[model samples]
Target: MIILLVLTVISIIASLYASFIYAPTELVMGDIQRIFYFHMGTVWVATVAFTTVFIASIMFLKSGKRKWDILALSSAEIGVLFITLTIITGSIWAKPIWGTWWTWDPQLTTTFILWILYIVYLILRSVAGDNVKQARFAAVFSIIAFIDLPLVYISARLKRGISPVVFGPGGGGIESKMLITMLITFLACTLLFIILLKQRILYEKIKDNLRLLKSRAI
Candidate 1:
């Protein structure tokens, strides 16, 4: 864990340098296009978060373990936080480039749906009352809801080439420097997600222990 923290800090610093300094300005959108570095970082991490939830949910279903439930919830919480970041950053980038705050574009619409589904997953965890029942419902619902994750990811590709794609046609023919910067930023985001997910799982464990203690004490 200590080594992971050190590596995470280094990666983030390197990513910032690469995004702001090493990467060249885009001829089309100028420096504003630089938003892609961090924006796409959030998108990548959010995708990871949902994938973690999906896998953890599957494990809980198979093993019927409380820890797996805790992991799924932890991942869902971080996933929600990061997806919110993605939407906000996308809107900020959109305003200057697209001259609008939002459009019901295919990817955007699917991302919105993905966000709402996980939000509902979190709510379900709270409302279920019984821990076992809550875990069961959350696991099943997440498995079902995860279907849209792939939809959100490939929305641009799946479109009939009618709308403009964000990362269009062979990864937008990006320069090597820009691609490297984005990849570094994505790695930093992945490390951050891992750290946060671990901390969140620990928090849930402590909360559960407290509840158990209180019931026994009473």
Candidate 2:
């Protein structure tokens, strides 16, 4: 864990340098385009986090294990954090380019929905507490929420929207330097996610232990 933390810190510093110093300013959007690297990184991490939640939720359902539930909850919490960052960074980048803080573009709409769904999942988990039946319900909801993940990815391609499709037809490819920077940012974000998830899970376990001790004392 100590080594992981050290590596994550180093990766984050390198990513910042790569984004701000190594990557060239875009001819079109100028320095504002620099936010793109961080934006993509957050998006990538959120995608992984939520996918982890989905899988963990499924595992909990099949195995009926509290650890899996803890994993799902921890991942969901971090997933929400990263998606929140994604939205904020996206809005920051969108303001100058789109002439507004936000728009009801397809990708944005789906992304918003995706965010809301996980928010609801987190709420459900909190309300359920340690109840097995309620936890199962939350798990099932998470599985259903995975459906929106794909919708968020495809919305810009299938519908007329303002979000840029960067990886497919009708998309503009990234420059090599910018691509490298983006990849480094992704590495930083992923490492940060792993660290956060580990801490969160440990915290949850400690909390449970405290609760158990209090009950026994009572």
Candidate 3:
């Protein structure tokens, strides 16, 4: 736990300093574009975390192990946190570039849908009576819902109507420095995700132990 916390802190500091010092400021979009670093970082990390949740769910079902369920649950929670930030920051970036607060762009739309699905997954877990049943059901839903993510990306890229490609190979815009900063941010966020996942899993183990102790006391 201490190691994970320390790593997270170090990564956060390094990411912030790197973005400020190493990353070049955008000439076209100006300082406002700096938000992309954290924004894309959050998105990239969240996507990976969520994908892990789906994979963990599958493993849990096959193995029927409580630890796998705990991992899936932790991943889902962290995934939501990162996805929330991704949406908010992306919206902020969109306002200046696209001249709107929100749009039904392919990426945004798919993200929003995936967000809702996870929200439902949480709700389902809360309402379930038995731990085993809850884990089983939620795992199923998680696996099914995550399948939409790749499709969302592909569809967004192929269709290309409302969603604007802000930065990338085909975007036709963006400075090299801005891109570097975004990549750095993404790497930092990935590191943060690893740290958080470890912490959450540890917490789950502690909770399970407490539950066992309480039941014995009763």
Candidate 4:
């Protein structure tokens, strides 16, 4: 835990140096374009979180293990947190470039949909009440929801929009220094995700143990 915390702090400082000092300011967007560093970083971590949920959900369905269920739920919680950051930061980044708070752009819309879907997933877990049923339902829903991940990634390509493409084929125009900063920030965010996910899973385990103890006492 200490190691994870230390690494996260170091990465964060390095990422800040890389973003603010290393990268050149854009002529059009200016310094606010620096938001892209952490914005894309959050989005990348959120994507990883959801992907973990998808894989853990599948494993839970196959093995019916309580540990897998815990992992799926933890990943979903972390995913929601990161995705929310992504949306908020993206909005802030968008305002200057797009000259508005929001537009019904394809990429934006798809990302919102993905966020809502996972929020719904979190709700389903809480409202379902029965632990076994909740886990089963969430596992299935997580698997279904992940179908949108790739779609979200490709949304810009499928539809022309004000949103820029930053990855995959046909994606270019980013300078080398900016790219390096983004990569470092992305790594830092990944480490943050690891710390957050580990903490979340540990919390879930403790909660389960407490609930089990209460039942035994009864």
- lDDT leader: 2
Looking at candidate 3, what is the lDDT of residue 105?
68
lDDT of model 2 at position 77:
95
Task: State every prediction's TM-score relative to the real structure.
Answer: 0.93, 0.97, 0.89, 0.96
Screening candidate 3 with a backbone cut-off below 3 angstroms (N, C-alpha, C), the clashing residue pairs are none
Candidate 3 Cα outliers beyond 4 Å, as residue runs = 1-4, 161-176
Question: Could you tell me which 10 consecutive residues in candidate 1 have the lowest summed lDDT?
Answer: 160-169
Q: Please write out the lDDT profile of model 1 over residues 1-218, one tens digit for every residue.
A: 99999999999999999988999998977888788889989999998999999999999999998888889989999999999999998888878877887888788898899999999999998787566876698789999989999998588777632223546663456788998999999999999999999899899889989999999999
Tell me the tens digit of each residue's lDDT in model 3 across 68-133: 888888888999998899889878887887788787767678888988998888777667635687
How many Å off is the CA of 141 in candidate 2? 0.7
Candidate 3 lands at a TM-score of: 0.89
lDDT of 4 by residue, 146-184 (tens): 988888879888885766788777675699999999999
lDDT of each: 0.87, 0.94, 0.80, 0.88
lDDT of 2 by residue, 15-60 (tens): 9999999999999789998999999999999999999999999999
Candidate 1 deviates by what RMSD? 2.0
Descending-TM-score candidate ranking: 2, 4, 1, 3
Clashing pairs in 1: none
Error of 1 at 149 (Å): 0.6
Q: Give the winner by TM-score.
A: 2
